[model samples]
Each structure stands twice: as C-alpha cells, then as structure tokens.
Target chain A: MPKKIGSKTLLLTSSPSIIGYAAVGAKKEKQGPLADYFDYLSEDSSFGEKTWEKAETLMQKKAIELALQKCSVQKTDVDFLFAGDLLNQCIGSAYASRDMAMPFFGLYGACSTMSESLCLAAMFVDGQLANRCVAATSSHFCSAERQFRFPLEYGGQRTPTSQWTVTGSGACVVAPSKQAPYLRAVTVGTVADLGITDINNMGAAMAPAAAQTLCQFFSDTSTRPEDYDLILTGDLGFVGSRLLERMMQAEGYPMAKLHNDCGLMIYDRVKQDVHAGGSGCGCAASVLCSFILPQIACQRLKNVLFMATGALMSPTSNQQGESIPGIAHLLHISAFPNEKEAK
Target chain B: MTKQEYALWAQQESPKSKGLGDILRAFLFGGLICVIGQLLIFFFENRGAGEMAPVFASACLVVLSAILTGINIYDNIAKYAGAGTLVPITGFANSMVSAAMEFKTEGFILGLGAKMFIIAGPVIVYGVSASVIYGIILFLLG
Candidate 1:
C-alpha cells in the first residue's frame, strides 16, 4: 500500500484507471450553463416512464449501460456495481441494478454517493479483487422534492437559499490498468454539523463539513492550492460556494482561482429560477462524467481534486427536528500522457 | 466553537436576499394582478351580473390563474413577482393547479386526491375556524 499522506487521505499503490463514463440529464438541465456537457438530455423529464420514480430508474439504467458500452464491457462482464440515489431504499438504483443482475452494493452517502461509490470501486480494482467495477448514482427533481421537501403538488415556495435538485444520473467504470488518467488518491470526510435546521438552506448546513474536509486534505497531503489545476467541490451552490470560500479564507488560504463548484456549473444562476444553483447527487455526478472526465481525457487539465459533498439527513431525521449533518469525499484525479495508443 | 456560535457565524456568512429589487418587482406585479381583477369585475358588471358581479369576477379570476399556471406562465411570474403573485386570490388557484399538475401521475386518485389539499388544507382549516370564532363574537356583541 502506498504511504498514507494524512489522517483521511489514502494514496493508491496501484492507481486504477477510469475507463468509461456517461451522463444523462433532463430537459431543464439541457437549458443550463453546461448544456453541452451532458451525453443525453431526455426530451421530457419522464423519459417515457409513467412516474417520476420510474423515470429516475430508467435514467440510471441508461447511464450505466452507456458507461459500460464505452469501455466495451457487457453487463455480464461487470464484476460488481456500486450505486445509489435520493429515494426510499434507493429504489431508483435498485430497480435499475436488478436488470443488470450484477452483485450490487447499495450506498447512501446522500449527495456524496457518487464519490463514495467511486472510492469503493477504486479500492476493489486497486486491491485486485475485481478487474472492473461500475459506479453509478441518480437523482430527480420530482422524486427528491416529494421525498425530502414537499410534494411538488404542494407548490412550496422556494426560499432564495434553496437549490434546485438536478434531474440526472452519472456512471463510470474503474478498472485495473496502467493508464494516464487514474485515481491517485482519496480522502474520506467525517460528518460535521452546525445544527442547521432550514431544509431549504442546505448550502449553509453543508459548508462547514466541506471546509473541515478541505482543511484535512490540505494538511495531510502538505499540498498548497497551486498544486491542483482545479479544486472542484460538489453541490455547494452559489451561497455555500461563497460561504465556503469565506470560511476557508479565514483559514489562511488564498483560494480565488482554481476553485469551482459543480452545483454552480450545473445551471445558469441568472436565467434559471434555481435560487442557489443545481444540487442533488446528480449535479456533481453528471458534471464529472460529461465535463470533468473529458477535460482529463483530452489533457486540457492535468490534475484535479474532486470533492463530492453531501448532507446526510433523512425524511424522518429532518421531520423529527434532527439537525442536518454533512460529509464530503475527495478523489485525486490526475492525468499523464498515455504511453500506449490512447483509446 | 459552540453550535449556536457556529450557527450565527454561518448565518452571517450566508448570502442575504436582494430585498429591494424583489420588493419592487413584488409591488409592480401585485398591482398588475389587482388591476386584472378589477377589470374582470367591470366585465362581469357590464354583463348585468349587478349584485353578483364580484362573485362572477372571482370565479373568472380563478379560472384565469389556473390556465396561466397550466401553460407555465404563473411560475415564471411568481419567480420575479414574489409576494405580488402570492397575495392575490389567483395565487390560491395556482396552488391547486400546481398540485394537480404535479400529482397527476399516481393514477389521479391517491396521488391527486390525497396530495391536492397540501396548501389548501391549512388555508381552509384556519380560514374556517377564524370565521367561525369571529361570527360567535359578533353575534354575542350584537
């Protein structure tokens, strides 16, 4: 095993290559700022499914199918699948995986499930336990609304601090290969809470966790802000993104350039009515698959630290007056020139 | 740091609402909604509804609001108009229309019927009780 850099980060001894990835977003997402980044946008939010839940299931299925197809790996060839969604029992992922028929590990890291699955997949591939593993996660605006906030039928007035849940899915494959773009390291974050109660203002609830994990990652690796080409964070919407910067600036780090948020990237703040920005696990997941991965693949960027942040709260927990807790997972994704012919 | 202290710092660090622009938009759009309602009342009176003109006008207003919501116009207006769209009776119609539009999927019965009262339920409950309590007080005073 590679020597541990810090308290939370693990430097992978055998860095596993991210072989394939796919992103599927809904119509509203197509109209967003990163419209060109997605692999496909459903003509309708339903994607020809009868219900929002079923539609989400289809989206997850499409993402996984396309990701594996890109790597020339069939459903039968996939050793295991790691997947999750913002749904009761993660039904969207479960229903989709039942068809793939691979041994599955259902994860629940809330919005951070994408990175959690990716980290676990890298572990499996790096350990030689699996030659290839598929990681996927999905979220839908309607499904998340009904489950978390209020039924859309409620016509709940969104506060300015509220973020729009992104309707999308993202999937990728991790494999044992000596390749250019690979998972070099990972940092699993601890759950941090500031006792934030406003469900609409997830940005504030989640920012502290993001800041703590970030401080931990920097301290452990002894890395400066200049080391990474891009330091991307997941789902810290407009408010949280700025708040995180302020919180970190006080920590004695100058983080103006090279910092971006997937939530901010997923939607247009001015034109779109999404108050804060696009959120949900799908926001970061889809952006990583469609936009960030391509950047690495084309060598437009060399090194990036992708941190997927999540607010780990449940309907029961929130309803019962429990404070929202947040977590963030980090992956050190870097690229070098391919020695072999690039695929 | 203590949770409350951290919470206060977090809240301060959080973004504040652009109240001035929002208030102006809300006022202008709210005035526009009132103007439309008055126009409907005039139209109903011109048709000889006389004593019942306001009742007909209210019905027309509700229908107009539902249609606006159906074609996705109301939400666009509500996005900017803020309390202006919310203060009008049209907003009540919007709540019902939005509910049906959102819950139309679960086969119309359990989905639509069950969820249809999300906003109206609270509004109706308080409205009825308040009126009943006021009625008793007025009756006793008289």
Candidate 2:
C-alpha cells in the first residue's frame, strides 16, 4: 500500500525497484561527456530510418527492448507500459509501443515525461495494481527542431540561453523486488508561471516550478538538503540550474553542494558547443538510466532526489503570446527501502 | 519572492550577447557575401550578358544557397555569421529551401508545396503589398 505524505508527496511502502534500465543515443549525445554511459550509441542520427520521426519511434523501441533484455524480462511479463516523447500527440511512444501489445498509457509532459511516467508506474506497482511496469521516454534533435523551432538547415542564430534537444531514448522496468536502488517516494508538482514568455529560455521558465516542488518536498518530509546524496533536476540546463540554486538558497535549503542537473551532466558545454547544455525528454531520461541508476544500484549513492521539470507550452501557445507554464515531478530514490525511516 | 522581483533577478542573471563582437562579425560576413554577389555580376557581365547580369547572378546565388543548405553547411555558417548570413539573398533562398526539405516528409502537395513558403511568405506578402501601395502613390503624384 502507498502512504500519503504531507500535501503532494507519496511514500511507497512497497518501494518498487527499477530492475532494469537502458539508454540509447545518437551522434550528438555520443559526443557528449557521458558518452560511455549509454547502452548503445549510433553515429547515424536517423537510426537507419527513412524519416526522423520514424527514427525516434525506433530508438524508443530499442531502448525498451534493451531494458527488458537486461533483466531477462519477457515482453509478455510486463503489466503496463508508460511512455512519451516531445513529438506531437506522443507519436514516438505510440508507434514504439504499437508492436509490443502491452497495456499502454501515453503521456505528454514535454521534457518531464520520463519522471512523470516513472512516478506513475511506480505508484501503480506500489499499490499492486500491476506486477511489473515499464517507464520510457524519448526525444530526437532533428524532429524536435523541425516541430518547435526552425527547419534543420534553416540559417538562424541560436541564443546563448537556448538548449540543444538531445537525440536519445531511455527505458526502465520497475517491479516489486529487493533490488539495490528503490523508489521511496514521489512528489507531483503544481504548474508555476512567472510571466516568462521567452521561447529560447526554457531554463528560466522551468526553474520556478522546480523550486516550488523541491521546497514542497523538503517541507513535507521534514528533510534538509544534507539528507540526500544528490538532488538532480531534469534538463534545467545551465541557467535554470543556477536559478534553482538561488531559489533553494533563499528557501534555506542551500543545495548548491548536493545539487546537479541532468542537463549539465549529460554534456560538456564548452567542448560539445551546447550553449546551455541539453534539453528535451531524452536528456534526463538517458542520463538517469545510464549514470544515476547505476550509481544507486552499486550503493555509491545512498539517497537521491530526482526531479524533472517541464515547460508546458506548445508552438501555438508561444505564437499566441501565452506565457510558458512549468511543472516538475520528483522521485526520492534510495539504495535501501527503509534506511531513512530507520535513521 | 514575487513574480516581478524574480523576473528582474532572472533578467540580471542571464548572460547578455556580446554587442560589439556580434556586430563586427555580422558586418564582415555580410560584406563578404556582397563581394561574392559582385563577383557573380562581373562574371555574367564579362560574358556579354549585360542586360541579364543581375538576374543571372541572383539565380546563381539562390542555387548556391540551396546547395549549401542541402549539404548541411549553411546553418553552421549562419550560427557564427548571425545576421550576416540572414540579410543577404542567400538567406531568403535558404529559408525557403530549408522549409521545403524539412516538410517534404509529410507529402508533396500539403507538405512541400504549402510549407515551402512558410518562413518567407510574410516577406513576400508585405513586399508586394508595399510595392503596390508605392505604385498607386507614384501614379497619383504623376
């Protein structure tokens, strides 16, 4: 059974473990600093597909397949699949799960899709609604570029604040098992809009939501920043991460020492020429699957707060002059199920 | 903090563009593009196509822009060159050609044909409308 914590947080008594996970990345991500962490890296961004959209679908499927294979979990054994991407209508996850024949829940949380899906999947497993579930998300640089910004070959200058959408996919299978890394709790965030309207500065738009969520979790659980080994936010990039640190400091959390963003961890900004590091759903997803999970699994990190922030605005919304609204979903993952409670 | 206060703080925290450096690069690259156009015009004039030199040069530039876009080199140049690449005739051709190449995946009639002018459509619309207004005013003055 799941226990309700203060306000927005939920503590999972079952502590569903992420039994298997995998990350797949394309050329740009391969060139990144965390390149060696990826399960599979392809020099071809298209992934042998005719179109970028189709390539995204294939990449997502490959990630899920790799995750399942890692745990020797057959496709028929999984109970539910939660997946999404940055594509319109979540066609990436839709088409990716089409041939799998699993009970699918399609989600759209922009860059926060990974955490959103993972939180829900963990909840379902915690409540015993499903025996095993898979959470997955993907994003492609080419597909996202054409849809959100300009064409791939369009001659336009990118602002320094603009983030490069990572071309990658990440998938994980969560089940009720005594695995080393376990899902302890989760916090669902409220939308925060501070009248930020700049389309290029997503970090600025999302930082508020991340601060709100992290603050809420800290207050709810009566925990301090020193309690967690790492406080990781998804794809806030350089600008958002700094803003989040300042906001957290103002709230008395002072998490600068403990905090690290998935965006900054995924790329070497200076060497990769990624102006504000990486963004998109895959940025957090791949980093979590490859780098963070492995650390927790090996007991190197005892406790972690993984919160992924998302800017919830479409191209139409931006063009219509609507301000960007941001949301963040958080999961408290730990190496032991009842370690904090015992402490 | 209040939204207004946070916005102000964020504005100050964000990095600003290097104004002088960007302007200098833009000037240099933009001037270089004009030089290429002049060379094309001279080449056409030397071939004795005096009346059609400008037209031939523009066509050659457009074709060169399309080729550069196809080879995936124009955007990289534009990144550093900034407005230098965008203010020239090649930029216009790049915009149209890039859109055409991107949307071609959807289909021919709806995707390529319709979206081919998506980026440059406003420029064409306003340009022709302004020209018509100018012509009307010129006739009235005469």
Candidate 3:
C-alpha cells in the first residue's frame, strides 16, 4: 500500500534583500526613469550602490531568524536551504545565505522563486532527506527594473497595461510531515508565450504565461477553481490576471470566481494610485509572506494555490525583438494535519 | 476613405458619444485618477521617492487606468463615471497598452516595434514638434 502523503509543515520564510526605495520627491533626469522625480529620495540619502545588496542581505537574515523563531528549529536543523532572488548571478541570495551558515541550493526562477524553493524543500522533506528545511525568494523593485530595463534616472511615461514593481520581499519555511503548516501538492509548468514583445509593460507580456500555467496546474491536479479556497496568482497583476482568466475560459477552463493576484492585494487601490496593478518578483513574494501567510496562519483561509509566474525573457532577448517567454510554478499550501495525524 | 469620410469617422470615433451617466463616470474616474496621483505624490514624497512624484504618478496613473480599461473596469467606470476614467493618466496608460496589445500579433519586427509608436508615437512627435517650435521662438527672441 502507498504511504499517504500527509501534511508538510511551513518551518520558515524570507525574501530578497531589499534596497532603499526610490524617494518620492526626486528630480526627473531628462532621460531617466525617475529623473523628473529627483526630490523624492530621503534627505538622508538619495540613490546609491550597495543599497540593493543591503536590502537583500537584511531580508535573508530576517528570514533565517523568523524561521528559527517560528519553528523553534536551529540553523543547523535545517538540512538544506532553497532560495533565489532577482540579482545578477544570484549574488544577493548566495551572499546572504553564506552568512546564515546553512547548506544551500540556490535557484533562479525570476518571479517564480517562491514556488521553486517551496517545491524543492517539500521534496527533500517528503523524501525524509531532512526533518526540517526552508524555501524562499526575494526581489527589489528598483534593483530589478534598473538591471532589466531602463535606469532609474530615465524619465518616460508608462503604458496602462504595465505592472508596477513592488518594493518589498517575502520568504517561507517548509518541512516534512503534516505537523503545523504544510505544502500539499506542487505542479511544475511548461513554457507559454503569446509572443508579446513590449517589455516595458510586463502585465500584458506575461499574461499568457500565467494563463498557460494555471490551466496546466488544473490539468495536472485534475481540479477546478473551487478545489482550493483561493487560486492565488503570484504577480500577473490586473491586466495579466484578466487575460489569464479569459484565456483559460477560451481554452475551456474558466477561473472567473476564484482568482486573485498578490500584486493587486498589496497596495490600497484608492490610496496607492498604482494602475494596472503591481508586479515584480517581490510583489508576489511579499504578498504571500506578509499578507497571505498571516491569513493562513490564522486559519481564515485554507488550501492556497500559490502560482508564482515569471517572465523568462532576458533584456537581450527583448532588445533583440523576441517574444517574451513566460513560466510559472504552482505550490499547493495548506494547514498542517491535526494533532492525531501528527502522531 | 476620402478626407471627408475620414473626418466623419473621426467625429464618430471620438470618446464622447455617451449620455450624462457616461460623462459623469468619465469625469469621476478621471478625478479619481487625479486623486490617486495626488495621494501618490504625497506617499512618495513622504517616503522620499522624490519631487518627480507628479510626473511618475501621472505616468503611472495613465498606465493604471489603461490597465483597468484593458480589463474593462475603466470602461464600466466610464459608463457610470465616464471621463472620470478617461481624462487622467489612467486614460493615457489605457490608450498606450491597448494600442500596443492590438499591434502585438503583427509580429515583433513590424508589429510590436512599429506599433510601439502608435500611442506614444504622437506624444513623441508632438513633444519634439512643440520643442522645435519653442526653440525657434526662443532663438529668435534671445
């Protein structure tokens, strides 16, 4: 008889190191992204190097600490650490983890880092490789956009279908057994590109990928939208989420009633004035960590399909006029088994 | 189409055909965009993102409205709050993204590259054109 795959626990979580956000009153450089907004940087300091690195490192340290605190597990108890971030050469993550002093298996899934890390950590724990482990992903809005697209100094208008970069981070822990918090199922995705090329606005560009991945997840799990309490999309924002819903419906799989984008949940719509919703790796990661996890811990909701989507296209590819390629990873997170099951 | 026909088409295509409900909705949506932009101005200023708040916020509002429009929220809002959604940066964002998406299927080379100029194209053109005229006037005056 097959052993039942019981509840997998959430041991801890963390996000990409964070950079000091762009000041609100900065001047707009004639050709920079925020050159006109030059006055927003704090009086303490405007923009600088190492800020990104600093953000990434601090977040990682916090994640490790949080995991230790919540799970009451030692750094040494975590047999492996799976992490990723939107930094050149994964330097932010690798460098951050180096200080934590844990065995590391660094990954790169762009915005899909959360699911990537979670999936791997779940496998290790499920296989009984280790009693406890952690999975996490992090991103900084300024650092990501600067590296991927235009410099922060470049000032230009944005398209409506564009996604705002979220300036936050997220991290989470995973462990084997149906203890307290757990990962239920995971679905890896295939590549999907409707061949959109406008890199500046990622919502439209990555919508097809989100649609493809969600549809595939449903197929792989043979489940429908109602199967889970919430079909949480990682960062497909407003436009992408709509398109994903529409495409799924067109493809004979609709998710109209139960779908939400993490980017959409972060900022208050009336207050933030962010249009077309938020994006970036941190958008989903932060929403999951700060908002979603808290809700899950409180038992306000159950069975979350955390599908982190990504734009796999590089800047070189965009500059080359190639269609944007997209990917997604689906992680099924649920409450841990009851007291009886744990025993 | 003849010039006369084209002019008629333009007249018909103008975003002003709806009734008072539509107009009010647009105005309200537009005002909401402005309000959001204002709040962003304050938010970023507090956070010290910079004085570029208005410019960035305006641009972001346009894009946001455009996204809402693409998702059909802007339209529904416009239907009730008409120019409310149509007059702000959100409107601008809606215009650009919708146009870009329309032309995306044309293939990257001619479609995406060429169509990028569709919405922002006029802005670039008029911006450069106005700047050129302004330069000439300044040159003559100076």
Candidate 4:
C-alpha cells in the first residue's frame, strides 16, 4: 500500500497531449500572422536589429497564457510566478512575467530550467507557503546564438553534440494543499560538475552534469530506477544521453529500463537531422506539459521522475573561459488512480 | 596614454632591451595556450571522452588561461591573437584578471570590487534595466 496520512496529494497534470501544446503554437501559424521578425532574422542583416529579445518575450508570454488557460487558472489567481530563459539577464522570463503582475522570480538552468522551476514551485505548494504557483522557461536559437556565439551572418558549422536551441516555451501551474491535482514530492538539485566546459558543443558539456545529478537524486530519495513508471532526464539528447547511461553503468547505477531522455524525444532526429534530439529548457518543459501530463491524465503512468539538467554557464562565463558547471533537479509526480472515477 | 601609444612604446622599447627574449617569451607562452587546448581535446578524444571531452578540454583551456593571466603570460598571447583571444571565452577571463590586477594597488573595495563587474557591466545593466522597463509595461497592460 502507498503511504497515506493526510488527504493532501500532489499530481502532475496538463493538456491531453504534447501535441496539444504544440497546437497552441501552430494556431499562431494558422492565423496567417506575419512572423516577419523570424523571417527578418534568417535574412542577412546586422544581427542586433533582429530583435531576438522581443521574440523571446512574445513566446514566453504566449506559453504562460496557454498554461494558464489549460489549468483553468487566471493570472490573478496565481500567487507567484517563477520563470527563466537563456537571454542575457533572463530578459525573456523577466520581461514576459512583468506584465502578469505575479511576484516574479527569474531562473536559469540552460535546458533543465523547467525542472528547476517545477521543483521550486512544488516545494512552495507542498509546504503550504503558496496556494498557487506558475513556472515557465524558454529558449530561442536565434537569441541564444547571437548572444553566445557568432553573429547570424557568420555562418559557422555546429558539431553533432550541439543542440539547436528550441524555439519554444513551457509553463506550468501548481496549486497548494489541494487534496488531489497538486504537487507531490520534489528533489532539489545540486551542482554536478563533470569538469566539462566546451561551449561550442553543449550536450557533451552538460551530459556529465546531468548524469551526476540524476544519480545523486536517486541516492538522496532512496529510490531506484524501478520506483517510477518512467525516469526522464531533461536534455541529454542523442550523444549526451548515451554517455550519461554509460557513466551511470560504470558507477553501478544503470537506468536502461523505462528511461528516456527528453531531448531526444521532442524532435524527430532523423527528419530534423538533429543527430541528437531537442534540448533547451523548452525541450523538457514542452515534453512534460504537452506529452507527460496528458499521459498522467489518461492514467497511463503512475509515478514519474522528471530530472531536468542544465549547463550553468552563461555567455559571459563561457566568454571568460570559466569551466561549465551543470545542475539538475528531480521532481516526483505520482498519478494515483481516481477511486471515484475508477468505480 | 591611448592603447595605441602604449603599443607603440612597447614596440620601440622591445627592440633595444632584450627584445628577442621578450618576443620569444610571448610567442612561447602564447603558443603554449593553443597547444594545451589542442592536447586536451586530443587526450579526451583518445580516451573516448566523446561529447564531454570538449567541454572538459575547453574548461581546462580556460583554467590554464586564467593561471597564465595571473602570471601575465596571456597578455603576450593577446598580441598574437589580436582580438581572437579576446573574443573567445578565455579572453573574458583574462580581462577580469587583468582589470583586477590593474586596480590591485588601490584597496580591494575600490579596485577589485569595483573592477570585477567592469567587463560584465553592460550586459547586467541592460538585463536589469530592460526587465524593469518591461515589468512596468506589463503592469500597465495586464
């Protein structure tokens, strides 16, 4: 029997499918809206005028709106908003959240931002500190590329390990002490430095960081890989995820069964020629908010561990040649069978 | 003096006083940085470090550059790379250390404390200022 004392429960919930979330973005396309900004970006011009920050701002706002709409929660209903993105000084999150008027907190975890925000938001809900929480994270390739690497005009070759910055945003809402449909357990992440620092290719740079954090989370929580129906690592796409598994095996903590990397799952690797899969904070967030949440609603999965990994280096840090550090936070969302509904 | 004048002075002085030795030292140290980065990449690749190898190698390069910056070796390297070394991440580290050292004679607060944020100043200011403005707009609109 599962341990049950108080009637309070934490559950991970979202729209019916990941594609449903993608449909929100697709709607913008269907409207035949002029996305001239994106078009202007790919064209040859001076990079700064491309207005990447503006794009990041818009995407994040839209994501927040969708997540709120799905949760049946209004902006005013949320007590606080925790958000993050890869732009300079987290402009994407801060600027976007500014209008929402919820107490805003900006965060960064490279690709693993969603997990970080979720873990923090869940803690607030579980502790009864807040009644409602909203979290969002995003990454835009155009914005991140211009800030971190060469200008858009300077077409440089990206290596296989380099993950294309996801053109997406993910947002989630969690409510407090609500008996069901609430946050369950959360595992705060620790800095896991595998001493990797190649900025040109982040998957490898961040893989060891993700692996170390995942192993630590399991150890701390006293949970095994089989404890959950699925164990997902945020963004250790094709190469990094494989490397992470190998490292885990070497350490005698393998996760071969029911384990998937969100990075690889988000995009069609073969069609996209994405050697690895999707990455960025959006990769994990979109996967969870879109795909995993729907599965939970369907009662297809019971216990799930969402481990989001982040490369903690910034453009300034990378430029300064500081060693890239990484962090990952594991959040547990258990979907108990609704007794009434089951009957 | 302008940065140009300083360059001219160094050029003139080097020719008379052990110029060759200083030239050799700069070249040797500068070459050493590149070699170290290359060697790290090779070693990790050979050991099957795969994706992580580059991150680690780049990290090592940064650390090595930092130490060299401390000893004033990286300045010589800058002469060769011009802006190449400065443009990369390692160059940022050099700038931090170099700025800190320049102000070292002043007290820590006035020197290092004030100077640490020098290189990173613009980005931070822009980030915070933009957020504040955006926040105001959001408040008005929402």
TM-score of each: 0.90, 0.98, 0.61, 0.60
Candidate 2 per-residue C-alpha lDDT over A231-292 given as tens digits, one digit per residue, 9 for 90 to 100: 99999998999999999999988999999998998889989888888999999999999999
- Model 2 is docked with a DockQ of 0.84
Model 3 interface CAPRI class? incorrect
**Residue pairs with backbone overlap in model 2:** none
Clashing residue pairs, backbone N/CA/C < 3 A, model 1: none
Q: Write the per-residue lDDT of candidate 1 for residues A1-343, one digit (tens) a residue.
A: 4447768888877878899999999999999877788888987999998889999999999999999988899888889899999998999999999889899999999999899999889878877789889999999998898788754533235788899999999999999766656888888889999889888888888888888888888899888778779988889898788778877788876675878999999888878878889899899899999899989877787888888889998878988999999999888887852223323
Candidate lDDT scores, in order, read 0.85, 0.94, 0.61, 0.63
**Predictions' DockQ, in order:** 0.37, 0.84, 0.03, 0.02
Residue B48: error of model 2 in Å? Answer: 2.4
Compare candidates 2 and 4 on TM-score and give the better one: 2
Residues B1-142, model 4: lDDT tens digits:
2334423432332213235654565456546667777898889999999988889888887786678788767765564444456555576566666666645544699867796556546756887999999999999999
Sort candidate 1 into its docking category.
acceptable
From the highest TM-score down, the ranking of the candidates is 2, 1, 3, 4
Write model 1 residue lDDT over B1-142, tens digit each, in one string.
4688777876775667788988898899889988887897899889998989888888888898899888878877787788888778888888888877778786588878887777667888999999999999999998
On lDDT, the leading prediction is 2
lDDT of 3 by residue, A38-109 (tens): 212222212333455555555555555665565567777767888888888887678778878789998888
Fraction of true contacts kept, per model?
0.36, 0.81, 0.00, 0.00
Better of 1 and 3 by DockQ: 1
User: What are the per-candidate TM-scores when only chain A is compared?
Assistant: 0.96, 0.99, 0.81, 0.82
Tell me, what's the RMSD of every candidate?
3.2, 1.2, 15.1, 19.5
